[model samples]
Target: MRRYTVSTAVTLCAVASLAAAMGPASAFPAAAPPAAHAVQQQPAPPVLVDCLWKPQVHPGDFMLACGDGNSRLASLRWSHWGADSAQATGTNLVNDCDPYCAAGTFHSYTVTVRLDDPKPWAKNPKMQQFTRMSLVYTDGRPDGFRQTMTYPLWS
Candidate 1:
């Protein structure tokens, strides 16, 4: 047999011609059209689960101390509530246990709150909740706490 060599471009052109000969419809199946009555549903925004395991969006007040009400967020005004993150300006109400936790004094400090790292909620797998919380104390922070504190949010 005589020596024959096929170039890469020639092979590609041969395959392309074959595909084109078959027509676009035969080469690629048409996608099914959406139903006429199908209503597009927007996904729910990211949320925070409260102490009682309740999903909350733009909550006015959320208790940080789930057990004893020692620390909590109050008067929250959310500036951003998106799919990836959320932010708010609020007051961190921390109780100072002068005598004891039972007879502690609650103090309010201005704070900026940020929520991120959204994932499927543990209790409710269908919904998404923020897994990380960051607080920046604008005025003052609680004793034995840093100015900027980052905590893992409860699922």
Candidate 2:
């Protein structure tokens, strides 16, 4: 009984050694390559989150004033939306607030908008949000702002 057990073990070891010497190619067939016409899906680009914490890409409008909706970007036509940055041409609508915010008049100005400096949002760690916004006034700007202005966007 002992001799038979030893003989079986030696035979199994010899078979394993033979298989290893033969290599993987002879032991198993190679996998086929992917179809040439198969489309490769790209990853979604980074986004800007609104006050409600909803991600947006190439949005037609975005609210700048989260507290009161007094200022916003309107009619945004995005020229570029990429992982690192985004650019758009739009109208900035700001409330003049001559007397008070409640009865303020909204004014429109033509502007070029840029969003960059992407970082992980606190609310959603998996999502990337643009943390910086820069605007260049092509036409009339708001009373207290320069021709070019940059602001750190909230996460």
Question: Which lDDT tens digits does candidate 1 get at residues 97-150?
Answer: 879999989999999999999999988788999999999999988899999999
Each candidate's TM vs. the true structure? Answer: 0.74, 0.73
Model 1 shows how many backbone clashes? 0
| Best candidate, lDDT | 2
User: What's the lDDT of the predicted structure labeled candidate 2?
Assistant: 0.92
What does the lDDT read for residue 39 in candidate 1? Answer: 81
Query: Tell me, what's the RMSD of every candidate?
Result: 15.5, 9.1
Clashing pairs in 1: none
How accurate locally is residue 47 in candidate 1, as Cα lDDT from 0 to 100?
A: 87
Segments in model 2 whose C-alpha atoms lie over 4 Å from true places: 1-41
Candidate 1 local Cα displacement, residue 19, angstroms: 51
